[model samples]
Structures are given as structure tokens and as C-alpha cells.
Target chain A: MTAEYFMVLGLLGVAFFSVAGALLGYEKSISGFGVVVVATVTALGGGTLRDILLDKPIFWIATPEYLYSTYAAIIATIFFVRYLPHVNNYYFLLVDAIGMALFNIMGIEKALISGTGMVIAITMGITTGIFGGLIRDVICREVPSVMRNEPYASACLAGGLVYAALFTIEVDYIWCILGSLFTTVFLRLGSLHWGWHLTIFRKKDFKNQSD
Target chain B: MTAEYFMVLGLLGVAFFSVAGALLGYEKSISGFGVVVVATVTALGGGTLRDILLDKPIFWIATPEYLYSTYAAIIATIFFVRYLPHVNNYYFLLVDAIGMALFNIMGIEKALISGTGMVIAITMGITTGIFGGLIRDVICREVPSVMRNEPYASACLAGGLVYAALFTIEVDYIWCILGSLFTTVFLRLGSLHWGWHLTIFRKKDFKNQSD
Candidate 1:
């Protein structure tokens, strides 16, 4: 697949996750302003982090297409707010995971192209992949799935490593993207299917305080 | 003051907030690893977001002093975990506000130096000021004060505007810093003293769902 194809996929990912973010916001008493902000944050937050860390001009600033995409997503969400009820019930994980899978490869490739080491590339990939949803979930006032038992960040990590390994072995770059994408989507889907979860540990005397 | 002075002050801010972050971590059943990660994230999260959005190399990568300070703070927290209970009682707000005030100016200056517009500079200032604490609270499973009715981000916003206005009027940079500093600190202190908070409005049919 061409980079343009990936870019299109990434844009779709942005739209999907922004809708998810807007839905998350709507569950609360989030106003229209809040919905727009949350949608943009969810769609662009991770890539913004990646671009900033790479010390490159932020992607959206250079290419207004991304911002336009986020705006479009927010507008779509606002118009369809009433139809967003079951959004959190089943659609959240799928859209988020798909977006994560696409963004993960994009971040790894960007980091590698910028001449970072393999470890940093992989870590950057995961950071770019999950950061948006992490911030979105946090803004929505829930524990991030990565911090909880969900296999979110771990899937990104695994897929990033797969991409790195493939790229290192002189595999076709397209294959690398596909391989990594499938790994992430399958891992997340498999986890959901089997109810796989990470274990939580606490101090011997964990105190739960209500704020 | 000299750049070195700001550097020192920034490091001190990082240490103090890392201590505060670890204390927050300890209040839960978070393990030592969790404590360390939370400390690092809280100490560096805001600046990381700022630098990234500004398209600069992260403040910590070029200078490891900040990370070392965070480490020192986390080490202190680990050894003194037994004494962290009272940390959340009264000290949390003071230390967090002080850190926010300092970091707020630092962000504004950095943005100004980067040649961003006044609006972006102010936004970045507030972003840098409160992002760490916001993430810290979220990670610690509490609502971020700024998200609710707290005057935290508002103080930073007011102080950032003060700094921007002073700079626009060609005031001495040191005076700008001090002016903004006092504004944020005094505003926060006043808010705490008089129980000032923003009024929240929930939509009549808001739905609460666990994600």
C-alpha cells in the first residue's frame, strides 16, 4: 500500500476515534464546545505527541487535512448526537483498536525515518497509538484501559515490535505495515473474545479514598 | 534571573511535583513501579506535552537533569512511603499549585521564544502548567481539579495572560516572570482560602456508564 493509502486510513481512524471521543463526551453533560474539543483531542492527541517528540513540525500544522478531518468528525458527531447512544456499548473498542493499529505503524515508520533507534521507535509507536485514547478515557473520567486489565497498549507494543523486526529483516515495507496492523487488531480482538486482561496489584494496605 | 536560574527552578519544580505524584500513587495500592512511573510522568508530562506541541525536542532528552531530579524524588518517595499518607491531606494542593505557577511561566517563555502567536503562547502556558497534575490525578483515579470547578487552570490562564500582556508592552522579561508568578500563586492561594470554584452544570439527562 502507498503512503497515501495509509494516510487515508489514518484519516479514517481519526474520524472513527473522534466520534468515539464525542460519544464519550456526550455521555456526560459535555456541551458542544466540549464535544468538539474532546473529538479533536482524541483524533489528534497521539500523533501530536509523536510529531512533537520527533521534533518535527506538528503534522496537522503542516497539513491542514488532518485538522479538517477532525473538524469534520466533530461536526458529524454533533449532528448525530442522539444516534450515539450505543456508541460506548460495543463500538468503542473496535474503532479505538482499528485506529490504534493504523497509527501504531505510522508512528513507528515516522520514528524510524527520523533516524531513531529500534527501541525508541517501538516505544514511540505505542505512545502514538494509545495516547489519544488514553487521554480521551481520562478526560471521560475513566481509568485508561492500558493502565487497567485491557490489552490495549500491550497490543500496540507487540505490533510495533513486529513491525520493527520485519523492517529490520528487509521485508517489504508494505508487508511490515500489514503484518503489524494484523497483529494489533488480532491481539485486541482475541483479547476481547477471550476476556484476556492484565492483573492489578496494590500495596498491602491499599486505601481507597473518595474525592 | 539567568537561564541557569530558571533551569534550577524548573528542576526544583519537577522534584516537588514528583514527590507529590508519588504521594498520590502511594495513597492507592500502587506498587513501587507504579510509584516511579507516576513520579516520572507527573514531573515530565506537562513539559513533554508543551515541547511536543511546540515542535521542540523534549526538555528532558537534551538535559537529563530533569529526569535525575524526578528519579531523586521517586527514590525519596520509596524510602519514605510510610510517611506518604498525610501527603494527600493538606500538602497536595499547595505543592501542586506552586508547581503549576512555575511551570506556567516556563511554558509561556518557551512558546514566545519559539515565535508562536500570543493565543498559542497562552494556551501552551496553561497546558504546561496543569497537564502534569491533570494526568496525575487521572492516573490516581480521581477527577482532575481543572475538569471540575477548581481555579487551578484558571490561575494559570490568568497568569499567562499577565505575562503575555507584559511582554507585549515591552516590560523587562524578569518583571514579566515575576508578575505572572505572583498572579498565579496569589490567585490560587486566594481560591483555596475562600473556597472559590467554578459552577458545574450537568445536562438534565446525562448518562453515567462504566467503561
Candidate 2:
């Protein structure tokens, strides 16, 4: 029953991820098949990448239900966008943060179970959280917002650290999961809400004579 | 002995891939440690991704020599670019094509050995050939050249088909490898030399009022 519940939750999160990705594609003037492609990648790309990097069986391949949710979400999003032409970036950020938070904890748990070190586990967690958006932005030909915009990966990193700390102290695994998820969601949403930004390295930022 | 020889060849190809990736990062004004990261990804990302999708051990993780060559190439290219200010797009295209051609065959061979279908094998071949540069371009905030600039993946597709046809017809594996490599390199180089391009979809291309 728990497994089934998590599966449903995972599929729902994938749907949100698909919609966020579709919105990005819509903004880029990508139409029809392109939006589907973007949405599919956005929803499945992160766990796929994480699984690949960890040399584990791909999640969506093992359970094809995720693909169904992704497709269904894209179709629904397209219709919703047609009626609501003003669908904006804020909506994208909101859903994206939720998905990222969910994936962050999932990644941390997976990495830990895989026997990776804390640092690598944290990195994997962040990779899971942001790679979907990173791939989305990359295909859309924009500097990955993870690198330039607010602290997306940083939020994941912070959450992963919290989870690790809790685990190290012999806390219940369930509490550790909740703590990490709460931390990730809080930081991610806080950044969006307060318009927090991280400074990126720019050519002008360096005053080297060689440059 | 034959496996050792192939290992050396793969590492050499990785070096070239690293240099091409570093040159791209240089062109984009990404300096220092960032170039190393980009070059490493360009050199290892394709094979790593292919292995991951195939649920196999990552090639670079299994063989650290590739990473050494990638780092060595990045350092060499940093020096090469410092003295050569006029390193242009043509140089990038040349090395990139060579590396892509090498990876195309490697991907096809791996996929066939993994017992994937011909079409999926060909798709994997194209993915290996172009994904490194695609990732590089994405990280640099450019539309992937593979998608827009020319017939990059198409060349890999042609080569992969040649390999599949030859294998199906009971051609010697050596001949099949050579045929595929030659076709991919020839088409890729030919496209570069002749300034060939594939037209991409644009807003103006479709006259639909719904658009």
C-alpha cells in the first residue's frame, strides 16, 4: 500500500513537472510536438539522469506509468494554456519547486541506500532536483537558471546536508526524509517569494588585467 | 592485446573530444575550472550517458585513464588558445566532427551488443555522437548546433544504418565497423565543407492562425 501511494505521488509530481516544462516550451514559441518533447524530458529527465549516473535501472523504464502521467499532463497543460493565455513564470516556479523538493529527498534516499558517501549523495540529490530544469533550459537555449538565477541546487544541497546530519545522529529515517523535504521546499519557495538571487560569475566581475 | 589497443584509441579520442569542448568553452569566455568541467563533460558525457541508458557501468568510472586524458587535453588547450586568439568556429567543427564520428561507431557497437533493436541502436548512436556537443551548447546557452546548424545526427543515423545493414547481411564485423565510421566521418566532414544545413522549424515556417 505504501509503495502504491508513493507511486501515485511520484506520478502526480511528474505531471506537475511536465506542466512546468510545457510552460517553458510555450514561452519559447515551441508548439505541438515540441512541447510534448520538452514536457516529457522535464518530467522524466531528472530521475532518468540520476538513475543513469548511479548505474541503476531507469525508473520510468521499470515503471512506465510515469510516462503516462507526463503525456497526460502535457495534454492538459496545452488545453489550460489555450484558455488561460496569461499563464506566467510564477506558476512555473511554484510547481517546479515542489517537484524539485520531492526529487531532492528521493535522490538523497536512493543515493544513501546505494552506499555513496555523503558528498556524492548530496551532489546526486542536487543533480536530481535540478537536472530536469537544467536540461529544459539547455534545450530551450538559455543559460540554466540553476547556474544564474536563485539558489536551486543550493537549496537541494542544504536539504541534503540536513538529511545527512539527521541520519548521522541516528534519527528516524522517516524524520530525516521529512526534514530534508521541508528544508528544500522552504528554501526554494522562499527564494522565489523574496526574489532572492545568487551572483553569477561574469567577465566584468573579474578585474584581472589578463582579461 | 586488442582490447588494450582499443582502450588507448578510446582515450586518444577522449582527448580530442576534450580539446574541442575546451575550445568551445574558450569561445564562450568560460575560464579556469569551468573549462575543465565543460571539457570533462564533453569528453566523457556521451559514453557515460550511453552506458547509463544501457544500464552498464560508466566507461570513465570503470577507466580512470579517460579522465586523465580529458584533464590533460583541457590544460593543453588552455595554453593553445592563449597564444592562438584567432581559433575560430571552423576549428571547433573539425575536431567536434571527428570526435562525434568516433563516438557514433562506439555507441552502435555497444547498443548492438546490448541487444537493442536496430532503430533504438541507431538512435543511441546519434545520441552518443551529438549529446556531448548538445550538452556543451546547452550549458553555454546556445541552441544545440546538432539541432540547428547542420546534419550532425543525420550523419550518425546514416552510419548507424550502414552498420545495421551490413550486420544483417552477414558482413564481417570489422568491415561493418569500418563502413560505419567512414560513412559518418565522410558525411559529417562533407556537410562542414559544403556548408550544408538542415532547415529548422521557425515561427514563419508555419502559416497556421492558431500559432
Candidate 3:
């Protein structure tokens, strides 16, 4: 759809995923303060980086809507955490996918508007989709999903390429957005269900260093 | 000191603190892959924020020196960690102080150069000094020093004010740098030594409902 519509969707995605992140943090027995920290990071961290890289004044600092939305997410999660034991893991994956798709579209659109080439637009899109989650994992002292075998950044990359292809073909903007979103969702869900993973290591002939 | 000298010192501070952060993360059982993430955030996070807020291209992206220095720092720490176990905590504090002081001075200087008012400059300086560490702590799933009952931000604020005062009085650049550095170090060390803290929590007689 339009860039304005994408921005609105991106904000909503952030608010939703922020709640999901907070719930995950609560499940991990992270402190209340820690939950808030993780929630805000999951929600605002990607968009913040995107704005910074684009040299735009931070969207949240100017609008206050993002901040209030994230705050609401955190409060909602905290109050509902006890009643939501089994929902965290599934919700995490779902909301994360939504956030990744929305951010990918928004970042690519912004880069295109800034007169960047398709390659740079795709790079920025993947960066926007994954950087926040990477930051969140690093803060939570967990290995980021990117560094793992999981197809996290891969999904983003695929979605970004799809978006660029759709744009190049002059497809309707709505169809382009849906195309990218479905690609990311299917890739992520398939990876989760089928245990699909990238092979990052190869058998080494060398002995142990101590030898 | 000349502005060039301060910038170099600040870079060195970033290098040193990044190494120190890596070592601490290792000790905390943070994953090997995550060490690089932590180091990058601890070292470059604040300046990155400052550049973004100023709508300037990120310095490290342009110069490459900052990234190279951080890489070197990580390698150095990984090799030296075992031989320096007892000193890790001390080194962490020392490097943190140096980085904070240099960042505080640099941030204030940059703000002044940009023609910002004294108050905003001071605020930016403190924010620049502390935000990286705040990010680092959050990633490590620890309570940020700022949120704790510590004088972390207060020390930076004090140093920033001293820098502004020196500038107002037309003090020589070298002496102004020294004044700010000394003020920051003394305040930070004194706070740690005597458990000094700023008054942050107003009395809450009612249920704590605010998020």
C-alpha cells in the first residue's frame, strides 16, 4: 500500500511485538524492569536504527505515539502474564514475523524514496527487520536468532528481494506488500516447523588447539 | 587539549572500554558470538546515538577506524582474559570512567560547536556518556547503572556543567578538558566509594501503578 499506510502498520506491529517480547521476558523470569526494557527495545529499537541510518529525527521522539503504544504494551503484558503461560512462545514467533515483515517493507520503501538502489534498499530492509531482535537477544544474554542456524535474517533477505522484484515489475503496491509479507511468514513458519536451518559449519580436519 | 586530541582520546577510550566489556561478558558466560555484539554496543553505541540525533552520518561508518579499533580490542581481550582474572572488575571500572569522561567532553564540545545552548549541551553530553553503558547493561540482562541508585548520570551531568563553565570563562582548551575529566572521575569514584546516589524516587504513599 502507500508509505503512510506502511508506517501505520509498522507502528502497530511494533506495539504488538513489544507485548510479545515482554511476555517472553516474563516467561524467562526476567525482572519487571527488565521486561519493560526488553519490550521497548523490541518495539522501538529497529525503527530507531532505521531513522538514525536515514538521518531522520527519531520517529518516536517526535511523535510520542510510539512510546505510548509501547508503554501500553508493556503494562498489558505485565498484568496479563500470569494468565498467559502457554501463549508466549507461539506469540513470540507470530508477532516477530509480523514486525519483521512490516519493518522490511517500511525500510525498503524509505530507502527507495531516498533514491537508493535496489541492493541498498534490500540491505536496509533486512537490517531494519533483524537489528532490533538482534539487540534484544544480545541484551537478554541469549544468542541472537540471526547467529543461530535458524533462518531469521534469511527470511528477511528473501522478503526484501521479493519486495524489490515486485517494485521492479511495477506491481500494485498492495500486492507487493502482501507478496513480501507472505514470503517472510511462510519462510519463518516453514523453518520453525520443518527445522530448516542454514549449514554454518563444516567438518574441520584440524585437531584441538591444545594438541 | 585540541579538539583533535580529544577525539583521538575518545576513540582510544572506546577501544579500551570495548575490550573491557568483552572480557566482562565472557566472564558472565555470555556466548562467544555475543561478545562482539556487547563490545560494539559498549564502545560505539553512544557516539552512534549522538551522530544520529545530530542528523550526521555515523563517524565509524565514514572513518572505519572505530570499527577496526573495536575488532582489535576484542581480540586483545580474548587473548589476555585468563592472565588478568583478578583485575577484570577494576579494569572495567577504570576503562568505563575514562570512556565516560572522554565521551562527556566530546559530546559537550560537539554540541557547542553546533551552537546549541549550554543546558542542552550539558544534557546531551551526559546522555552521550551514559547511553552506551545503559545499552550494554540492558543487553546483558542487568539493571542499567542509570536505573539503579547510582550517581552514574549525575557524574556525567556534573562534568558536563564544568565543561560548559570552563567554556563560558574562556578557559584554555587543555585546562577545560582537564577540569571536566577530573570532575567526572572524582565524582564517579567518590560515588562508588561512599555509595552516593541521586534522589530519583519521590515518596510514593499509594500503590505503585505507574509504568
Candidate 4:
């Protein structure tokens, strides 16, 4: 509704994703400190990349509140998941979709305001939405879901394209933001519900080699 | 050596890592274009992070030659590795060590010149050295070697500390660079030769959870 409102939602998104990240690290048998590190990376990694590419100060470094929120969420989730068992499993997709939608739209807005072209703006949006999970998966020694046949980055890309197109057509900023966020969340949730996936292609003669 | 000499060596280091990245992507059966992307990420990912954290213009975007070098090296490696299967395997560690040493020292020098304190400078140096490989490994669905028991980041840390300590003691700039480079390369190569590795630790009661 308002910039301030969006900011608060964005921080909530960061916290939700931190829970996912911490749970992931817990699965890997990481230590307490290590789980915190992994969760922080998962929460802030995408925004950090977007800001860096835009040559802006890193978002978390510029706003300590995001870091604080991430830690707070991580602590809460650790206890909740530890006691509840299966809570994280049930809510992972919902949290992931909400976080992706919030971060993706915010990234597009930041890139547009920075005067980048629509394509770069959209690219930045997708980067901000997906890279945090990608980095977390890497650290936890898993292939990123985005790289699989899942509709992860594709959902971000669709949302980014929608936002850019709406902005280009002189849509109001609020409507543009809302439109994009809805697109991302809807697509992500729908895909998960229906088991929709992207297709993978490879060369006919390509041989898999273990290096 | 001269600054110009180090600059040339740095570009070569980028090229070497590009080859390693391309080879890894090839092992994963990535498409031709995907290999190029992965290789470029592996080569430039660290320096990009360094420049961003330092709030400076991205080095590759500022100097397009680095991008050109990455592309050229990726193409070369693709052709080279396709025909010569064992080549990448034999040369991977050497190329990685050289690249790490060059990038690590350059990062330290850049941070010091940027007026950052010694600790930040050293941290930036390690970030520049290892983040590229870390990102690359993540994209390729492998756990980063640095996050494992490997001495990868530890070598960078050791080198960064050496450089900062030398510079603090009023060592000549050239000597500082040389000292750090030698330290990194020696430790990395020696670790491989002697099978030395960092230790992993976890809580006694930590139970592995599958998420």
C-alpha cells in the first residue's frame, strides 16, 4: 500500500526465508553458529547481490534492522521447528513464495529507479528473488531448486517481465507492484500445487562425465 | 614484479579459473551457452563481489577486457577439454591456486588503498579469492570446497593476514604483494601435496535431520 508498508513486508519476507535457511542448515547437521551464518546468507544474499550490482551500499549493511530481523526469525524458527517438527516442511513453499514475490518486486523498483533499462531491471529483479536460495543451497551442498526442472527462477522472470511491461505502459506504480507480486506468488504457488515444471534440454550426444 | 606485470598475471589467473569453471560445467553436461555463463561466473565472481563490497565500479564492467578474457578462455577451455579429457583434471588445482593467490593479493591492495582497516582489507582479500569458486560450485550443484575440510579459504586467509601484517610493518608494496602471493600459492599447493585440510567441528548432540 505504501513504501513504508512494503518495507515492513520485505523485512518479514527476509525473516521467513531465514527460517527456511536455518532449517536447511539444521538438516545438514551444521552447528548453531553455522546455522545462523547459513540463515543470514539465505536471508540477505539476494539483496546484497542486487545492491552490489547497482553499486549501492549493501542493503543489510545499510539497514541493520534486516539483519536483526533475520536473527530474530532464525531463533524463533529454530525453537518452533525443533518442537513442532514438520512445521517447516508444511510452510516452506508458502514462505518461499511470499519472500520471492516481495524481494522480486522491490528489486525491479530499485533497478528502475536507478535508471537501468527494462531488461536489466527485470534481470536484477530475478536475481534478487532467487539468488539467496541458490547461495544457501550451494553452501548446504545441494543443487539449487531454480536449476532443476522447477519453476523457481521462471516464476521470478515472469513476475519481472510483468512489472516491466506494466511500467512501460504507464501503469500506476502501485498497480505495477501489486500486479507483479501477485503474478510471482500465484505462479509459484500454482506450480507447487499442480507439480508444474520447466523442461530441460541437452545435446543428443552429450555424455555425462564425473570429474 | 611491476604493477603492469601483476595486472597481466591477474588476467591470466582469471583465464585459468575460467577454464576450470568451463570444465566443471562440461562435467555437468551443461549446454554450450550454459558453460560460458558458468565459466564467466567462476572467473569474475570473486572480483565482482570485492568491487561491490568496496562500493567501486565493477571491475569487468569498467574494464571490458576481463569479460573478453573470460569469454575467450571459456571458449578455449571448451574446445581443449572436449578433446583432451584428462587435461582439466590434472591442471585444476594449479589453476585454482594461482588464481586465488593473484586475486587475494590484489583485493588486499585495493582495500588498503581504499583506506579500509587491516581486518576489513584481509577479509575483502579472502572474499575476492574464494567467492568465485564458491559461487561456481553452488551453481554446479556441488558443495564449495572452501566450506568443506579443504584448506581453500584458509589459504586465502593466511595470505591476506600475511599481506596486511607486512604492509602494517612498513614493508614495500611490491614485497607485500610478493609475500602474500607466495604464502597463498605455497600453502595451497602444499596442502594438496601433503593432503592437509582444515578440521570440521559440530556439537556432540547434534543430530542429522533430513528436510
Candidate 5:
């Protein structure tokens, strides 16, 4: 698909994941007010950070559509939560993955367009991919997966590196997007199944620490 | 006090608050990782949001002193948390007040300098004052006081309106800042003492069901 197509899809993914996050928070017994807070963060957190770093008007404030979509998502989650059961968990993962991939692609493109070097571009890509989820977790009072043993950030890193490498080789734009998405999806799924993670610290290191 | 004095004091206040936040977060019963996260947020959160909204280089990154001060604060907190029990709560109120006053004044000034009209300037000032705390509360998994019944945003609104009025009347910049700070501090203190709040919702309002 073209870049523009992916960007629109990404925005939709953000809306979907936001609702999913709210549903999950509701199931976890988070307060109604807390659910709205988490939903807003899950939807707009990444884009807000990206716009701030780029020194641009916030995307949502500039265009009302994002805000409207987020509001709709929140309302939908609040009203429809009781009807759904195990479906939310599966939907959360799917929407999260889509949002992650879309954000990574858009972030890389924006950084490149701003004339950033490969290192900064990749960093921004990874940041955009995971920042919304990080904000969601932080707001839910859970340790952000990125700061823990999860391969969440690692998958973004791999996708970003792939995008950068492909761009360097002057690969076709469509192929680059596909390649990056494939890399992220594979890494994430494999990690989930095989329990893959970065070796940040050994279990022995924290053996003496109280839990 | 002169504008320069206020600026210097504000910076120093930022340093003090950063240290205090880090120390409070590092208490014996607190998780070490959580402490670092909260400390970082409490220290730089307000200024970061202010700079981002103003589209300026982040104040801390532009001047490394902020980072240095935050690190120093963290270290000091770690070593001295046990010695100071009541200090934590008192420090929270004090530093928060100082930060609020300084940031509100600076945000209005910056907006005025950027050629925004009085209304926009007032809005920006109020936003700058509260955005950081909103972020912090969200991260702490609490409903943001601004979104709830707290008079936090209302106090900002009052202060900003007073500042705008003074500026429109061609008052001295010093008087304007003092007037705004006074209005904010008293209103905020009064709110806390009286438990004043603005209820955005009424129980009867929800009876309409999607009107």
C-alpha cells in the first residue's frame, strides 16, 4: 500500500486501540474516569509526543478529526464493554500491532522529511511506535513493557532499522513499508510465543533484592 | 522583584522541586524503578510541556544545568529521605506553588511576545500552568485534578485573566506578574482550604441518555 493509505489506516488504528485500551482498563476494574484518561493517552499520546518533538502544531488540535474519533472510541468502549468477553484481548493485540507499525512508518517518514539523519530517524520511529503504549501503561499504573523485559521496544527497533536500511539502499517505498511491518509483526509474535527478550539484567543480579 | 530575579528564582525552584520529588519517590517503601520514573516526571514535566507548546527548544536540553540539577536532586533525595519525613509533604506544596506561578507568568509573556492576542495568551498561560500536573497525575494512575472537581484549572484561569487585564491596561510588567501570582496563590490556597471544586457533571445530566 501507498504511504498515504498507511497513514490513514494508522489513524484508524489509533482510534481502535484507544477503545480497546479503555475496555481492558474497565475489565481491570479501573475507575470510569481512569478509563477515559487511559483511552485518551492510548489514542493521542504518540502523536502528541511526535508533534512536540517536531515543533509542529499538535495533529489533533490542528485537525478535529482525531479528537472526534478518540471521543467516539471512548463512548463506544464505555457503552459496549459489557457485551464483549474474551474478544477484547485478541482485539487489543491486533489493534496494538497495527497502530505500532503505522506509527513507526509515519515517524520515520516525518523525521526523514525533516532532514534528520538515520540515527535520529530510527530513534523517532521507535519512539513513536511504543510511546502511546508506554503512556497507556504508565497511566494504568503498570510498569511499561518497554522499561521491563518485553520485546516491545525491540520489535520497533528492528522495524526501524529495516526501514532505515531499505531507504539507504534506495528501495521502493512500498517494499520498505512492507518489510518494516513484516519485521515488527514477526518479532512481536515470536517474542510472545518464545518469550524472547533483551538480556538487560540477570535473575541472579536481583536475587538479593526484596520484591 | 524584578523579572530577572523571578526567572532566576524560577530556575532555582525547578531545581529544588526536582530534588524534592526524586527524594520523595525514593522512600524506603517505594520501588526504585518507579521512583526514577516519577522523579523525572515531577522535575521536568512542567517546563517540558511549556516549551513544547511554545515551540521552543526544551529549556533543559538547551541548558544542561537543568539535567545536572535533577541528577543532583535525585542523589540528595536518595541519601536524605529518611532524615526528612514531614519535609516531603511541605516541599510538595511549596515547590508546586513556585513552579505554578513562574510558569504561568513565563507562558503568558512568551505568548504575548509571539504576538498572540490576549485571550490566546491567557489560555496558553493557564494551559502551561496545569499541563504538567495533568501529565503527572495520569502517569500516577490518578484522575487528573484538572479534569475532576479540583479548582486547579479555575485558579489558573483567574490568574491568567488578571494578567491579561493588567497587560491590556498597559500596566508595568512587574506589577502584572505580581498581580497574577497573588491572585493564583490566594485562590489556590482558598480552594484547598474550602475544598472548592467545579463539578463538570451533574447526576441529573446523565438521565437524558445520548441527547
Candidate 6:
């Protein structure tokens, strides 16, 4: 039952990720083919990377339905996303947060089930949630917002911790999933609204010392 | 005997790749720790991505010696690369060509070994040859030289086809490796010397055309 639930949410997240990627392409005014390609990569890249790192068969290979879903999302985006006259930040944030949140929870669960430690699970969850977008941003020749100023991975870390804690006590699986999902989504939304940001590291410039 | 030879060359290529990445970090004037991180990622990212896509155990995981090798390369780079005053274009090009050429051959060979088709072998070869540098370029916020020009991926494609054809004809494995490596390295150097470039795809802008 729990596995089925995770599968459904994971699939849904892929659809959201595909649409979000397509939206980025549209915002950048790329070609239609580029849109589809970017969408497909965004939807599958994170989960594929996570699975590969874990030495497991990719989730999409096990169920080709995921590929079909990504295609379907691309088609949907061509009609809807491509026609938008102006960027809709709210819709993008909501969809992106939800999708990444689902992926975060799924990645952590996969790691824990594979007997990985809690810290590793959280790190993997963050990687799954944000790495695809980082790749997308890099491809577009823009600095990744997640890397510079956003609580995106921070939200994933918090939600992953919540999920792991719940699982540790043998709490109900349904609540564990839902609770973590809610935490990430809300955390992201709150950060977006309040302008919360991650502090970045920078090397001290010694040239200034002489002055 | 052939497999073992390829293994040694591929390992040597990884060492070179790691050093080349570290050289890039130094050229960019990043901190020491940041240099090592960037170098490690650039060295391993492509092979890691290839292994994951092929659903094989990551080479570094199977042989932790690769990690130690990366560390050694980092130490070497800190001493050698940091002292270089100007853009050592010759050294960079030579090392990069050798490393990427070897990776191109290995990726194709691994694909063929896994019972994959010819097209996939070529694609994987290109991916393995260029994707690590792609990751490096992205992190450094530069346009990927491969995507833009200089016959980067083109050389890999040519070399991969040569290797595959030679393998198909049951040629001596040593000759196949040397022939392809020479082909890629020469192709890149020729392009560099002659200012050869790849044509990029761009949609015609109607507004610009009218203006």
C-alpha cells in the first residue's frame, strides 16, 4: 500500500517537473523542440541520478508509464505554457515546490530503505529536489536561484528530517508521506513570500588587507 | 588482454581529467578547497552519469583507488597549476584531448559490451567525453566550449565512429585505441589551429528580419 502511494505521488511529481521545465523554456523563448527536450530531462534527471547513485534500476525503466507521462506533460505545456503572455511566478512556484517536495520525500524514502544513514538520506533528498533545476538553469546560461538565494534545498532537508523521524517511530506511513510533503511545500512557500535565503560561502580577499 | 589495456588507459585518462579540472579551477582563481571540489566533480561526473544510465556499479565505488587518484591529482594541481602565470593553452588542450578521447572510446566500448545498439554507443561516447566538462563549464558560469564551437563533440563523434568501425572489423585492439585517440586529438588540434567551428541551431527571428 505504501509503495503504491509513493509511486503515484512520484509519477505526479514527474508531470509537474516536466511542465515546470517546459515553462522555463517558454520563458526563455526557446524552440519547441528544445522545450520538449528540456522538459523530459528535468522530469527524469533527478530520479535517474539518484537511482544510479544507489546502484538500482531507474524507476522509469521499471515502468515506462513515467516516460509516457513526461511526454503527456510536454504536450500539455505546449498548448498552455507556451501561450502565456507574461511570466506567472506564483503558478510556477506552487507547481515547482510541490513537484520537488514529492521528489525529496521519495528520494529520502528510497535511501532509508536501502539502509543508508539519515544524513545521507537527507542529502540525497536535497539532491533529487534541486539538482535537475540546477542543470536546467545552467543550460539556460543563468545562475541557479537555488544556489544563490533560495530556501529550496533547505526545505527539502527539513522535510526529509521530518519524514525520517516519523518513520523512526513507526508512525503511520500515510501521515509520514503527507506530513513531509506539507512541510516542504509550506516551507518553500514561506521562503518565497518572505525572501528567505541560504547564506553562501566566499573566500576572503587578501588584497583588501594591504589597503 | 584488450580489456585490461583499455582499463589502464581509461584510468590514466581519469587522472588527467582530474588534473585538468583542477587546472581550470586554478585558472578561475578559486579557493583551494573549491578547486578540489570542482576538480573531483569534473573528473567523475561524466563516468558516474554514464554508469548510472547504463545501470552499472559506479567505477569509483568498485575501486576506491580512483578517489585516492583524484586526491593525488588535486595535490599535484595545487603545486603545478597554481604557479602557471598565463593561459597554458597547449598543455590544457593536450591533456583535455587525451582524457576526453580515451573516455569517448571507453564509453562506446562499454555500451557495446552491454549489448546496446550502435547509435547508443555513439551517444554514450559523446556524453562521457564531454559531459564532465559540461558540468564544469556550468559551475563556472561559462558557455560550454563544446556546445559553441571548436569541434569538441565533433572530434568525439569522429573518434567513436572510428573505434566502433575498427572493433566491428576485428582489428587489433591496441591499434584501435591508438588510432581513435590520435584521430580525436588531431581533430581537436586541427580545429583549434584552423578556427573550425560547429554551426549552432537558431530560429529565425521575424522581428529582426522585418527590421
Q: State each model's CA lDDT, in order.
A: 0.78, 0.77, 0.76, 0.78, 0.69, 0.78
Candidate 2 CA-lDDT value: 0.77
Best by DockQ: 1
What would the per-residue lDDT of candidate 6 be over residues A98-140, giving only the tens digit for each residue? 9899999888888888889999998989888887787777777
For B38-100, candidate 1 gives per-residue lDDT tens digits of 667888899998987887778775566776778788788667655443445456567777788
The DockQ figures for the candidates are 0.18, 0.13, 0.08, 0.15, 0.09, 0.10
What TM-score against the true fold does each predicted structure earn? Answer: 0.60, 0.60, 0.61, 0.61, 0.58, 0.60
Model 5 residue A84 distance off true place after TM-score fit, in angstroms: 2.0
- Predicted structure 3, TM vs. truth: 0.61
lDDT of 1: 0.78
- What would the per-residue lDDT of candidate 4 be over residues B1-211, giving only the tens digit for each residue? 3668657867987898898787676667664344554677789899988887887877765566777788789878767665565554548778888888888987887787789988898899899999999878768767788867668888999998888788779877788878888999899889888888876675443555432
Scored against the true structure, residue A27 in model 3 reaches a CA lDDT of 66
For residues B1-211, could you state the per-residue lDDT of candidate 5 as single tens digits?
Answer: 3557655745764665566456445433466667766766776776777677657788789878777777777677766766866665556655666566667776777667756666556656765676666666675655555544455666777888898888779887778888988888777767677876554223233334434
lDDT, candidate 4, at A71: 90
User: Model 6 off-target regions past 4 Å?
Assistant: A1-8, A18-45, A52-95, A115-124, A134-144, A147-150, A157-183, A186-211, B8-45, B48-91, B94-98, B114-124, B135-211
Error of 6 at B47 (Å): 3.4
List clash counts for every candidate, in order: 1, 0, 2, 0, 0, 0
Off by over 4 Å in 3: A1-48, A56-129, A134-211, B1-3, B194-211
The residue-by-residue lDDT of candidate 4 on A1-211, one tens digit each, is 3668657867977987898787777667796688898889989988988887888878788888988899999999788877876565447778878888888887887777777666667767877888888778777878666655557777888898888788889878788878888999888889878887653334234434532
Q: How well does candidate 6 score on lDDT at residue A85?
A: 43
Task: Name the candidate, 1 or 4, with the larger DockQ value.
Answer: 1
Off by over 4 Å in 5: A1-3, A6-10, A85-88, A165-171, A198-211, B1-44, B56-130, B134-211
Off by over 4 Å in 2: A1-9, A25-37, A51-87, A111-127, A138-143, A146-150, A153-165, A186-202, A205-208, B1-23, B29-40, B52-55, B60-130, B138-211
Lowest summed lDDT window (length 10), candidate 2 chain A: A200-209
> Of the candidates numbered 2 and 4, which has the greater DockQ value?
4
